[model samples]
Target: MADNEFQSFLTELRRGSLTLAVLGCLQESYYGYGLLQAMREKLIDIEANTLYPLLRRLESQGLLLSQWDTSESRPRKYYEISEKGRLVYKELLAEWRKMQSSIDSICGEGEEDERFN
Candidate 1:
């Protein structure tokens, strides 16, 4: 595949996983920039543009809770996962593990077949 095509495939693969990652990270409260920095620290390459909209969407979906803190010179909106979000995150994690196990099994089978050939 062309470089752009490979990038497109990679982006699609990261989409769902990104949601799970965001939900997992928001177990603690973080403002937009803080959350972005934290995710980057963990080697998750998410753009600010993508993260903001997703935060809004998750908040709107009742999967997250947001509060504004004005103690500092500037006010920032902080987000944390709700109880519902924790439940959903657990479910998604389970599903991801199951999918990963199946993929691993298939790849192991492929390796075995290669050894026979």
Candidate 2:
């Protein structure tokens, strides 16, 4: 594949993980920028515009709670998973495992991908 095509392929991996990362990071309260930084630490190159909308969507789904923190000089909106979100996260994890097992059964276990570790 060409360089651009390969880059696009790698970008595909980012799609499936976004929701998981958002849900996982918000386990503790974090604002948009903090969540972006945390995702970067985990090697996800997510943009703020994309992430903010996603956060809003998740919040709308009753999966998250957000509150504006006015304690600091600059106020920030922090987010955390609600009880429903925790339950949803658990379901996602179970589905993810099942999906991976089904894929492995078809695709074989001998991948060089570090994600398998």
Number of the top candidate by lDDT? 1
With candidate 2 superimposed using the best TM-score fit, by how many Å does residue 115's alpha carbon deviate from the native?
13
Global lDDT of model 2: 0.88
CA shift of 27, model 1, Å: 0.6
Question: Model 1, residue 112: displacement in angstroms?
Answer: 15
On a 0 to 100 scale, what is the lDDT of residue 20 in model 1?
Answer: 98
TM-score of every model versus the real structure: 0.89, 0.81
Clashing pairs in 2: none
lDDT of each: 0.96, 0.88
- By summed lDDT, which 10 consecutive residues of candidate 2 come out lowest? 107-116
Expressed as tens digits, the lDDT of each residue in 1-117 for candidate 1 is 799999999999999999999999999999999999999999999999999999999999999999999999999999999999999999999999999889878787578668889
Candidate 2: C-alpha RMSD after superposition: 3.1
- Model 2, 7-61: lDDT tens per residue? 8887786666688778988899999999999988988889888899999999999
lDDT value, residue 12 of candidate 2: 88
